[model samples]
Target: MGYVKTTFLMAAMTALFMGLGYLMGGAGGAVIALVMAGAMNLFTWWNSDKMVLKMHNAQALAAGDRFGLVDMVAQLARNAQLPMPAVYIIDTPQPNAFATGRNPQNAAVAVTTGLMRSLTREELAGVVAHELAHIKNHDTAIMTVTATFAGAISMLANFALFFGGSRERLGLIGTLAMMILAPMAAALVQMAISRTREYAADKAGAQICGHPMWLASALQKIQHGAAQIDNDAAERHPATAHMFIINPLHAHSRDKLFSTHPATANRIAALQALAGTMQPNAPRMRQTDMGPSTTSVPKVRKGGKRGPWV
Candidate 1:
């Protein structure tokens, strides 16, 4: 049922894009706009991982340098039956993560320094597993296409207002109406489609983690941390907000109506309900099956305080 609704929403978004193009100039302009959108989609599909990583100034981590995190991601990928994606760490204090690539084989997962500092190892695994789920379910590709086309629609609407529109097409009233409503409609379509995809991804991510409570806990932390932090990159590039694990922008406070992510509370509630069905005593799988570690733990600094890694 969710899949069906998502398919319909995607179709609607495409239709809206094409219609906006038609309004901008007629058949020729619509064709040109769609062709450009297609070309951009293809480009973004192949290069979006690099683009996003650069946007956040994220640095790829070597397995030897961050062996623990690398090993955990590798183990999760093995369980998910996926190729291990390139991993990166962003310096931001926001506890968020996102996955990008055209497909599972080419994917990359990037998490913030804050996420590593804030989450327990188990909770961090849940977050990585959720991103792996995005790669597995192909949400990254779908979202890249949606973002590409939605931006094209907005571009076409702006073009119509400035260049393509003619005074004689209709009266002044018609021109005014098109200018006012076209961009709003395109934005509505983008938000509606993005929200649905987020829900589907959340469900798939919970399944991948196999313990919904981990994700519930992670979400609780992310929602609170994200609200306070400024993700400057996401702010500069608002079009990519839907690609994030959490909406990385702060501009939604005024309207709340335009947010691409579903309500955090609602998402947490669903995850909690899923957690209720799992056995409370289920043992968590380890990165290595040999046994628990007996080595001395490394020290970690938090809030200017020192502690042993737990």
Candidate 2:
């Protein structure tokens, strides 16, 4: 997402928060909610990275690890003209990755161990580049903040249940509907933004890596793995779903209004379009599109950089 879009999302989320407050306690509640929203925005700007990393149980990746993962990220960061971002490993079995921070200077890229086990070195670089694109675009700050807003909105919606009909201007029935609908509305906006940004990231990442097909190939593998394996952390904290390259909670092969990420096929198609120009006569990405149940990445190799880095 761009600065303009991020600003819009921030406004929309605060509005949702305030609207819920008004429903529960009238104008006075709206004032309080506005104050809370301002505080929350500032809080997320400073701390959302730490909160998200903690939420997923992400651990700092050992520097100069045997995987060469850290080194690869460093190289890519240089390629993207970005400062080195913190690298983290999430121990989930699902193959997915995300970037988080308030800005490019403080960003972090997190990948699952399952991702290390599933994607080739080139594919992993593609994923990292994609995340860097998000960091470079300042999408992480908004995304992390959005997750916090989404979660808080859900909580506030639930809190409305405790208020009697007379207390809420909406009354009991209206309160119940808002309780159900408010968070859903927030999620819809979250997903919509995610879908839009994923495409932009894919393009920028391809340019950063200088190989569109690499990311296209990785997306196919990740989509397949994500669909079959469970990401327990993501399921527990569903609000963070939009941060991932692929929605860790569920797999969607087609686009929909509420889907957290774009359809895998559509993303691949977009990347493939880039590949056509950058890599003339390159064979279409195929055969590697099957699920992880049927296929796994090649083992770490000693000589060249074709296999899994880990």
TM-scores, all candidates, are: 0.86, 0.85
RMSD in Å for candidate 1, one decimal?
Answer: 3.9
- Leading candidate by lDDT: 2
Best by TM-score: 1
**Model 2 scores what on Cα lDDT?**
0.81
RMSD of each: 3.9, 5.8
lDDT of 2 by residue, 146-194 (tens): 7777877898899888866324467678778888899999887777677
For candidate 1, the per-residue lDDT at 194 reads 68
Clashing residue pairs in candidate 2 (N, C-alpha, C atoms within 3 angstroms): none
**Per-residue accuracy of model 1 over 162-269 as CA lDDT, tens digit each:** 654433564456666766676677677677776776666676666665777778788777877789988877788888787777788854433266788888888888
